[model samples]
Target: MKLKTPLLLLLVALTSCGNKPDLVQDNFSFASTQLKQAFVEMDAVRSAEPREKQALRDKQNLGPLASPRNVEADGTLHMVISRDWTSGFFPGELWYMYEYTKDDFWKQKAREQTALIEREKMNGGTHDMGFKVYCSFGNGYRLTGDAAYKDVLLQAAYTLTTRYKENVGAIRSWDHSRDKWDCPVIIDNMMNLELLFWAFKTSGDSLFYNVAVNHARTTMKNHYRKDYSSYHVVDYDTITGAVLHKHTHQGYAHESAWSRGQAWGLYGYTLCYRETGLPEFLEQAKQIENFIFSHPNLPKDLIPYWDFNAPGIPAEPRDASAATVTASALYELSMYDPANGKDYVMKANTILENLSKGYRTAPGKDRGFLLLHSTGSKMHNVEVDVPIVYADYYYLEALLRKQKLEKEGTAIL
Candidate 1:
């Protein structure tokens, strides 16, 4: 399927057909089965000796957010937490749980987490707030018609809009002094633009779409390398629309390919194509996929390291979080172009299988986190192989995708 704009928009609408008994009912069965197993494992890990004894606070009082301790691969609970508030993402995961299982626990947690993130006022600093909030509460509203979620999403959208710099032709990633490059763009921000698109529909506003197109076009021009691999960051001279320089802020170095960031590009552009039917967006998505899947660094199980070109991964282990995100993105992409559907589906499946098998600690090991070996920020030597909230969210989403497929047998567009 070519997945033109009208067809993709139709699919997006159908995604919210929660009342469809055949789809939700069948997937709910699979979700319930896996969730039951996960729950038992979580409980056993919670009651384990190591976690009970060396709680996050007891170890070194790493930080407030890290207080909810969980075991790492080294069989120790890491404490030194940085960043107290992670917005949109934390609550977003909770909302996914609520949607998947209709569990009140997930809904309650979403409300609590949203309030906590809002209290910290973490909205305007970066583009991540859209993914963090909309993926959770925005989804909540879309699926359930909850007006409250709309209020939350709109507020977050306003915060995102205020960050827009007309002079730069892009939204600023950070407000740091060291790097004051105007209109700097990151591939990860593409995921955030979905919320902007949604805001346009809700408010009948053109500004949101204009911002999204500018961001998308800027990324298309600057971030992509010859092989389709992308730079982690690109600074643009907002005035002349000239490329200032390309740098890898989060990856190993300027030339290194970060697997997770590439995944973001693939998933983000696929989403852009879905909304706009831009042939360029679809082509870019395919280009990124070619680079990612063809890389020799891909593990046999299809999970990726934190960086594709990282040195001696066994010595300094890679992040399984990258794999989880890629899996979910591939699953989403499969619907658009079924020619490579099985390849992407199988890749996602392999990652999920490996994660549920090896990466996950056994029962009575790590209660709160579903997957281990997630690297948060390798540059800072922090959370080298600990649980990350985003990894957990994506892992659950991949599982949902698998369940959705096995049950629904591919809803033909």
Candidate 2:
């Protein structure tokens, strides 16, 4: 059945009144059972280790916002211990865990880890303040209603805006030397626009909303190919906003589709539609959704190779990070497109099942990071086939979203 309205009624519509109600409910019930088991396994990992406690106390002596990134060969938790794009994911994971398990242990850890990066609210040198701050404090405030978290989020939103180049109509993504990139705007920047939207909604400041819409419009004009597969980076002339180049720093080639960039574009546009109720953004999202599901190289499990055009085919690395991000995006998108809501929800559930059963770490392993086999930069030969922090963050997020739908028949707000 094609959905015409997406809401809490979707689960009921599928299982209670559909053609094969029993079969549908049975499969959905089993999927929910498996996810509940995953929740237990994750909590066990957290309870078995004091790693986060130690990291919190030790990070002060190491560096700023020292988020745990991955595990070392010796089974020690490798720390970011510096400014990087992924620093907020760990804390965001903690917040979700706290919300899921309702354990004070995770709540305290979430608070501690979130506090470490409080300074990113003022650091505008890079364009990743959203990833570093919003995912941390944004979830924190959403769940806890702490006034302090609100203040930090607003500050980070403002700091993120400082990177906006009026001429380019987008935020500068990288801070490489002036000669190297006149004004670089990456597809990943789409993920950061959520903070700006939140800023405007919460603060009643249209400045934040205007910049975000402008950036989205500019990216929609330039970043996409005819197929809705996106370029990784679009460099603009700093003075006149003219196109300088469209390049791929992370994918297989300049013309290939990078899996994670595509996920970001899908999620970003879905989010833009939710925030603005704009038909164009929803159409943009559905276009990317169809591209991802119809892509020739997508695996049976729905995970994509690091690059859709990568030469290695089945031998190329499967990106759990991209899959997790897409799972979360699809779950949210399902709530908006009723005609395809059942398909979207079922696909999201399938992705969660694959990750929970196939890509998840053995408990008490992976330095307590949950998922495995995420590729960071396969072209650069960095962090290939290893567990990554952002992968875990989105995995937990998908879990939570799925759980919400299972129980309350609503998407996570």
Candidate 3:
């Protein structure tokens, strides 16, 4: 699952080729073109389904398969149902498109896709309400001020709180794999706290705020090592509130730094600082930034391998998803840390440029996924090197943030 050596060399060359004045704008234009074609192809697949199947889906109240998760082994579109954690990302991408282009077409498409995930507002089986709902409906609400979207977000926030265990001081991450973990809380759960924060601000509920802060504080204490590299999963004794195990579930080993987990910690703590103005959260984010950018294993292009400690070095698969997340977090972190702001922006820009130049799917290829070579879970041998939905979501997000920073000197949007 390693990237071809020739492609890796080309990526390095492209990263060193220097930046262009219109890189963000040009990439946005390219993304819009590619996504339009993707939408058409996706819709065709939905339309080609048998009438009986469609009727049964309607009767069962199953929403249309509106989100593109990834491409299957045969290169067919792998669209997912509403409950999938990634279901919100495609709609979020459409929202970013609308935000960038201000086109009614993208806005209408965003609305349609966002609406499909509304049923997940009550899905508390997993600790990914933010990924499954907020990225879709939350963005929709942010853009349109839609009252219904607001209601759904608040309800989703309440449902997410159901997973919170006061004893563990964290939201339970998984209900399955009971054999492996008592109360597993993964680093990825940090990303879901955004929904709770937003709900607190919107609904004036201290419960939402407290749960988010507790989770952040608890995770800050338990999930990270002295070097600020994070474990992928931290199992806890649910009743005793004591740490039971620290597992690198998706990484190279029990103690290796999972690339995406590091990105999540960096982004999550940065966001926590934004929401709560806590110096500790800011410092944690900075430590993670240093760890990622200073790591010798990080590629010259700023795209990290699937695991920072993966044994294969140059031959390991790159995770474009991690780069996208890191780039997006850096744009926000730059706004907060002024002394290093320029450097963070420069690194983020390099990542975006390298991704655009080297990792992007060829025009009209891979069913129009924006980028390639993301590893979802290398340990499980899943999605080792492929185009993932969240990579495209965060790529669009980073592009939008870059544009905002350029125009307004702020990356808030």
Candidate 4:
């Protein structure tokens, strides 16, 4: 069958991914080239689009799919701003630029973004603040030793800890509506648990770590489907503590896998394994990875359709954003499984190469946003096939991971 070629190619690709020092050296050269290119792009973006004028909060007012291209739809370049759920991701993007190039321009943007976020703060009662803020700020403080970043991150962590409901033994999420849903949990929230776990170590607050672990356990028990693909949303009864319903808000149906959400589960559980060393978490991550990689319908690039099972192929389109997230997750997972790490590394490499080569704009259409063809909340029918800020963030993160692995003389595919 024609489809068999990619499967056969996957096996063949795995062979070259062995523990060859030359592979590491080759990867290092490639990564260095890309990093240098990223620096060039970041500097160009910074010079062209100054941070103060286009502050972080500008993202709030913009409509969906409202990228820098949104300027075209409207007369003024009304940049969206505000500390929303997607708030933490922008800083992560800037931090990646700073980390790779040591560019003071990126650092200044990151600092300004952090200050703006802390000053207003988002609807902090939800669990996502950890990912949207702490992952950016926590990682930022760890890298720079900047006390201001530390202060803002600590405040955000404290806000998250305060929301930990002892009754449900988990953190609550999204309180704008749906009042009856007391102990609401999302698989996406699992990635945010690392922020709390890190907060515990940074601040010596065991409660934060304990809370994160409990929340993770609760999610593992409730969210995973029979096939190991996770649900987008799980409603837990605040009183009886039973799972009320497992649904998929972002997917086509309650059972369909939202590609990015699945990536979050794969990435989050791997993170849980790293933090707790629990075999179950790693086991789940591996199972999810198998489901993700083994999907026959995935494009040659390995980036998944927005909903893998969504009817219609080229007409419906795949979410390059999901592929980017999974690429970074697979790269992180590769570190733990040396024997099979190459398969993941190869998959990650496939995704990144395709993204950089296929999904990236021609460097002329969009000067500000880096990667292209990212889907943001396709269920709500918004931001289809445009640059998502977080997609650029994860794409850069994957690159940094490759850079780190190559520098450490590790195998890279």
Q: Which candidate is the best by lDDT?
A: 3
User: Can you give the TM-score per candidate against the true fold?
Assistant: 0.78, 0.85, 0.93, 0.80
TM-score of model number 3 = 0.93
Question: What does candidate 1's lDDT look like per residue over 1-413, in tens digits?
Answer: 58899989888879867455453244344434433444454445445646644575457633233223334556554331223323445456666677777789767766665554442223466667666567666766766677866877777777787777676677767556445566677778888888888888788788888888788887877888899999988886767767787878777888999777888888788778877888888888878888988999877777777888888764656678788878877777787777998888888877887877677644444544566787766776766777765676777777777777776864211
lDDT of each: 0.69, 0.82, 0.92, 0.70
RMSD (Å) of each candidate, 1 decimal = 9.3, 7.1, 7.9, 8.3
Over the stretch 130-244, how does candidate 3's per-residue lDDT look in tens digits?
9989899989999999999999999999999999999999999999999989999999999999999999998999999999999999999999999889998999999999999
Which regions of candidate 3 deviate over 4 angstroms? 1-21, 48-62
> Which one wins on TM-score?
3
- Runs of candidate 1 exceeding 4 Å displacement: 1-85, 119-122, 179-183, 409-413
| Worst ten in a row by lDDT for model 1 | 61-70
lDDT of 2 by residue, 1-413 (tens): 67556655787776666664332234333333433443454455455557776587466543443576765444555565436778898788778777866778667878988887887788888888878898899999998999999999999999999999999899999988567678999999999999999999999999999999999989999999999999999999989999999987899999999999999999999999988888989999999999999999999999888999999998999899999899999988988889998999998888977876688676544555677788888888877888888887887788777777777877765
Candidate 3: give the clashing pairs: none
Clashing pairs in 2: 3-338, 3-339
User: By TM-score, is 2 or 3 better?
Assistant: 3
Model 4 stretches with alpha carbons more than 4 Å out:
1-78, 120-123, 179-182, 409-413
